[model samples]
Target: MNPLNLPFDSDAMLEGLRPWIECESPTWDAGAVSRMMALAARDLADAGAEVETIPGTGGFGDSLRASFPHPDRGRPGILVSGHMDTVHPVGTLEKLPFRVEDRLAYGPGIMDMKGGNYVMLEAMRQILRAGLQTPLPVTFLFTPDEEVGTPATRGLIEDAARGQRAVLVPEPASADGGAVIGRYAIARFELLTEGRPSHAGWALKDGRSAIAAMARKILEIEAMTTEDCTFSVGVIHAGQWVNCVSSECRAEVLSMAKTQADLDRGVAAMEALQGEADGVAFTVTRGVTRPVWEPGPGTMQLYDLAKGLAADIGFQLGCGSAGGGSDGNFTGAMGVPTLDSIGVRGKGLHTLTEHIEIDSLAERARLAAGLLMNIR
Candidate 1:
């Protein structure tokens, strides 16, 4: 029952990768993402899989959920996960078309994940062709907007994963080329302040400056962070000019908490800023983009299963955790055993230098197929 018997065309996989890279499908650009999903869905459905396009939360690309029943497997399933949205913004394609030189292919989202999506697609195709009976069923979720925050699609991912045996995320390979097993929780906050404006020279003493108050709050927020619980004042917008005391100022914070207690403490510190300034009004919006994922009961078992499967296929596997976040964090947080960075090994991700290892495609595809074969 070698899963490598599954039908796979390296040429087809390469074909899929080219268009994905040539198109600039950023998280917010729903149109391009939709087209990509449709193509993937059409191909997947033709291969005896049920497919559904989950509409996004009023954005450019929604999510695509597809399931392939094993020849004789029953209920419990394994989900292969990835995101469609990339960090590339609009017009990036023209700036950086897909290029190949010296065994490297560079483009917008190739390694970050487009190539991983291809790996999944080709692996599934090969499995179906082989007519193998897997021990468990397989589900694939391609979410949009993962590059940004997965605010619009978190619930969908959780719902698909409920009662599943485990979930696998194909984020890019680690810098050390090892697979990732854990990730940090992400919290983003917006700080807005409002104050009455007055002439800088004539009535400066009477008006409270929103920008000054905002600056002080930013400093306090920074001081609240630690080595494990990190924080950054990411974006700030405020004030008009020097002629008048500014009436409004806004700042955004991106915080990463290492543990549940750290998250609670960070949130409390963020909320505490609301009443710090007397005359200036303040508001805060908080979002936990992804939850922290560490080795636990469900996850450790899942890792052992995946590692065992990889060993059977002759691929030595290693695992590590990361400070960044992903949808894997969401399911892993919900108590599902989760493993990430199962995609093709690659060097650069989310940059113009992004590329997937051409040689790893076949091996990783076989690895994915084998993992799916042992899902239950």
Candidate 2:
């Protein structure tokens, strides 16, 4: 079934998508995420999907699995994977409320993912409404924690992808409307500095300021950025009183590498970092990591299929490696054919100006629906 022949009203899709964007499911807010999951569950159930709710662990919100029945239900089939979390906080709605301006639908998480999720759901609904079924069984996995990395759901994502025919990730499309065939390796680090505190007014020379040491370390870390790898310090906290030298400081670091070898060297360098001055102690703790996923023949084949489908729908779809990581990293690294970032076309992700091209509502949905019907 060619989904393009079916009626897809962009305005109606925008309205259907408004509630999802308005829900505000930030990763840190478990209750808000749960509410968003509930909304999705209801929609999937209404569309004739067998929905399963996985209780969240480690204080994250619940994940969801919605399956569409087919003759090949028991076999490995398509996995439509994405996240329900956003980086924006709870009160962001007051600042960036849902609105359509000049053919762009603006809201927190609208372009990053909610728009893509809604489009996929609408595609499924349209297929079912037309009395059609995909060649293979379809399963949708919605995760609750992705903005801070999939620390809570990595195992679940891998388990779901195991033995699947393919994994499709509807992360935000690239700036030029390209899909992701490969993703860079990513590692997170937590740094801490400890020093001796003394009165800033009288005993300044006796004080060893942790903040000063951390500032130097931050510069050193950022200076490590090269063509192969990049480092950034995104968070920092220190000092409690103005009259006393800081005794402790902490920061979060993120590093991205084009290859595993480069990332390994970067990790080793980070672990070997030392304090900038005497009497200050520095420490680095490794956190979540995403292994690099280089495009394989299987992934290339999937991209070829998607590219052809896009051409039939009157758009030229491009494919390449992207910087940020997604659940596709797990599946693609495991050698499963994976396609990432086949979502809405838009810009300003992770900011108050986040939004999607209103016209992409129908265009991308057609692309998604085509993949569902054509992928065996």
Candidate 3:
């Protein structure tokens, strides 16, 4: 019953990841992402996985779920999570070019997660080929728009994962090859300010500058942060001309929090700051892109079980946390024991230099296959 000693074909896993990275699935574009998911579903079917599609919730693209229902007794179903979309656009792949040099496969979306997707699929293929069935069922849920937000797919992810015993999110293997058990909540907000405009030199005091108001608000917001919570005013736009007092200005703020209390405190502080500025009118639109992937009561139990399985196989399983969010965040927030970063090792995600380590691919496939065999 040792899962680690199970056979794995590293070349098969790498071959699966190759064609996926060559395809560009951008977040904002629906057509490309849709095509990618359809292709993946076909491949998974070819590998013996039964596939289903949750119709898009009026979003740009759809979310797909693949499953290998088990016929064994006393086993629960485990959900595997990954995102199908990338941060790159249509022609970015050809422009930047997808190239494999030595042990590295470099291309758009290779690391951020097309590579991770392959790791999951190949693991399942190996398990099926090995004629090993877990005590429970195994399912794969892939979503689009994870780079921007799971706006249309968050609810679907939660619904699909509600009854699952555990979730494995193959986002990316950690920078140090560890798995992530926790991730910070991500929130983005836009603050727009309006004020009266007048000639700066001709009647300086007669006009109120919206840019000045926004500057003061930014300072106040930055001062409200502590160790557990952080906020940044990343983009700001104000003023049409140097001689004229700015009538309107806007700034986009990105916030990250480690816990629910921290997120609530940050939200309250932002509201207060927005209300404090009386001279300038303001409008704020805040979006909760992803909630912190907090570990629930039975989370550590699953982690321990996975570690035991890893030890039985031949590799070691280490758990850690990530500052960024993934589709795992949506499932974890819905009270699932979601374990993330169970994917291939890749570096330089979301940049033109993105690459996946060839050596890491096979190891990841082995890890995922071993985990699948042990999940009960």
TM-score of 1: 0.87
lDDT of 2 by residue, 132-179 (tens): 989888999999998887999999999889998889999988988999
Q: What is the lDDT of residue 341 in candidate 1?
A: 82
- Give the winner by lDDT: 2 or 3: 2
Over 97-160, each residue of candidate 3 has an lDDT whose tens digit, in order, gives: 7777887878888888888788878777767777777667888888887887777777777877
Model 1 residue 53 CA deviation (Å) reads 1.7
Q: Rate the local accuracy (lDDT) of all candidates.
A: 0.79, 0.92, 0.79
Cα displacement (angstroms), candidate 3, residue 318, comes to: 2.0
TM-score of each: 0.87, 0.98, 0.86
lDDT of 1 by residue, 1-376 (tens): 5785555555557776787677667887789888778777887798778998987775658788888876544466788889878888878777777877776677888888888877877787777777765577888899887876777877888888888888888787676556777888888998888888999999888888899888888888888779878889978998768989998998889999888788888888888768645798888888645778887777777677767767776677778778888888888888888888888788867666777777677767887887777666
Candidate 1: misplaced stretches above 4 Å? 4-12, 71-74, 198-216, 238-245, 276-279, 309-315
Report model 2's TM-score to 2 decimal places. 0.98
- Count of backbone clashes for each model? 4, 0, 4
Estimate the lDDT of model 1. 0.79
lDDT of 2 at 144: 98
